[model samples]
Target: MTSFITPCDSLADVRSAIDQIDAMLVDLLAERGRYVREAARFKRNQAEVAAPDRVKQVIDKALAHALESGAEPEVVEAVYRSMVAAFIQIESRQHQALQARQAPDAGTMSGCICA
Candidate 1:
């Protein structure tokens, strides 16, 4: 749950609060990154790494949570879409790496990831 903060009385205070929140966001993203790395192990190829249905499900859940938390849905949707896209790329790389390690002489997985 998000913690409540007091109203800012000055620009410096506002910036400080934003910085703190950003730091927290970075920390959260790092934790999420670790999980993404682990998720790569379960995926067999780029297609599974970039599962469009799973992406939609994640966005759907995020949008619902945005409504529940009084967040702007448009901003939430935009951020999630971009973040998910980037994570898909990262996960794709990890998936390729894992596949290579499992069969080093076989080479990278073939075919593009398609929905």
Candidate 2:
């Protein structure tokens, strides 16, 4: 549950509200990053990290969500594109690390490479 400010007038009050919203966005992004890491575990190779079809689907969904929420679709699409690209890179690194850990010589290393 979240509490939203109504009719903010002062600069300080507006900044406070923005700060709260930014905190929530950070929490959401962290949750999304966790899911991205989990997704990396399921992927067989790095190619699956930059999945074009899923990217298109996500962008389309973001556009629809922005339109439905009275936000600018273009802005939402741009944000999603940038966010997805970053996540793809993270996933790619995670995939490579997992692959390396799975290699035969990985037995010499410690516990949980994904950690």
Candidate 3:
């Protein structure tokens, strides 16, 4: 669970808080993207993305953290799944790009990029 500081007494304070939140979100998402790339490499190599053991580990850890932070487990799970789905979509796009780059036929290259 991410905790944010918000001083909503003034418009300036609200704007400042929002700016800070945007920065934090960017930083966190960038970090998560790095992990997504690493995971994509594994996925490209034909390794499983939805391993039950790994998913269980994540859910258990998230649940524990959410409990400690007074956050709802279901809310955390929903947010996490949404973020993960976005990452996976990015990963799939990257994999497609790599495949297009490696294609032996030049016609496929233009088709992929144009599409």
Off by over 4 Å in 2: 1-5, 106-115
Model 1 Cα shift for residue 30 (angstroms): 0.7
lDDT tens per residue, model 3, 1-115 = 5676654899999898889888998999999898866675555432355444665677778878999998898998887777766776777666667666666885545546562
On residues 1-115, what C-alpha lDDT tens digit does candidate 1 reach at each position? 5657879999999999999999999999888888998999998778889899999999999999999888899999999999899888888889888887787464545664867
Measured against the true structure, the TM-scores of the candidates, in listed sequence, are 0.86, 0.85, 0.62
State which candidate, 1 or 3, has the greater lDDT. Answer: 1
Report the Cα lDDT for residue 108, model 3.
Answer: 48
lDDT for 62 in candidate 2 is 88
**Model 3 steric clash total:** 0
lDDT of each: 0.89, 0.89, 0.73
Query: Quick one: ranking by TM-score, best first?
Result: 1, 2, 3
State the weakest 10-residue window (summed lDDT) of model 2. 106-115
